[model samples]
Target: MRAKIYGGCVSRDILNFDEAELIKLVSYNARSSLATLGSNNAAKNISKKHYDSLLNIESKFQRRMVESDFNNQILESAGKGDYDLLLIDFLVDRFHLAEIEGKLVTRSVEFLRSGIKPDRVVNTFSDQYLKLWKEGVDNLFNTVNNTVGLEAIRINKVYWTSVATNPQDSMMLNEKWDIEKNNAKLDAMYEYVENILPSSSIIEVDKNLLVADSDHKWGLSPFHFTDDYYRRMVKIFNA
Candidate 1:
């Protein structure tokens, strides 16, 4: 999935930017880092010589992850502007907060190489994470092209998911769900998001949408979603 998003921006032809004929979307995982910085020490994946160049892109891309960007050539402005929607996932940010705060938590690859149990990492970064959450989220929004008028939404957790595993990959970089701490920051995130964006710009997820039950279909990880959910999410965009 990460690679797919990167592929969208790696070159220039991913999407046409006609506001009338094209509906553009810019999405990124804000957890690891932004622009060029790797949030959960994921920066190591990038070379120091080229890392800075990777970010602050004229193309408008990502951090631990990469994203689609709107360049005059890659995309001509849709007339009103370029993109029609902007989506952010709250999961990676939570995962990122844990990595930043946990005294022992580190990127899964780093932890694996050191032979440390992911769950054994101590939970101590909550305070520090909360302090930076609002500032980070706000700064991010401010960075967008105002003509875009971004629509932001938070994804509710897929129930019965394990705390210590990466849903997309089986990497173990976390141990506890830390729901108390995670949700506290999430609430604060929504509060600030509401204040900065119009009520319609933010989508409030249904509380019972992904609960664990006989219909349970999200065991793969917290970030994974059902096809129906994906279809419904696209409906939220104004494209």
Candidate 2:
């Protein structure tokens, strides 16, 4: 099945390694929060090409994600009805938003590293953010139901692991991140989304498998889970 993914690497990483190619990634928009989806393009002063040259980022995937956020193209593409499935996770919701050119933008890692500072940064936990996020979620669901149907969607209830599989390896995440706080926010998001979506469409991972992989290809991070975690996800997808 062809799928359009919106969120962080939680679902994308699993499909990326699917040896059987059970699912194909038709479109992907990452490092983008729900708050930015229906808003105006964030980078109005600089052209995308010229802006890319200024950024120190090397990963093409990250660059594309930044572009998606800049253009607010998640719903633009999702409305086209080109894919059979749409998978969404709230990992990017952990990111704070920025106000640029009077538009809310996802203050993603790539965007921060790009050197284009914003007029203001808004915390995701703020009341203003909650209002916008709820509206965005409503818009997203409405768009999907009108075009792709709700049955074509899946929500990955993702959370960061605080433990490491290897005892010797560091269990600490990036100094900037608060594991407990982020997980709590994720809990709220999961609850909010689950309340709107059907339980059958939710992809739930075993908490027992929530351990960081020291030898992960992307290096050690709370979200960089061990092999068994990925294996379980694959089984869920196949089922």
Candidate of highest TM-score: 2
lDDT value, residue 115 of candidate 1: 30
Write down the lDDT of every candidate, Cα atoms only. 0.34, 0.78
TM-score of each: 0.48, 0.89
Candidate 2, residue 189: Cα displacement in angstroms equals 0.9
lDDT of 2 by residue, 77-147 (tens): 87888999898988888788987667787887788777777889989888777767877787788888989
lDDT (tens digit, per residue) of candidate 1 on 1-239: 11101111111122222233334444322223222122233212322333343354333423233221111111112113434444444444444321222222223222233232233332224555544555445444544444444442222222222232224232331243444555665566567667876766555445444322222243443334334344344444433
What is the clash tally of candidate 1? 4
Clashes by residue pair, model 1: 19-78, 32-39, 33-39, 101-125
Number of colliding residue pairs in model 2: 0
Report the Cα lDDT for candidate 1. 0.34
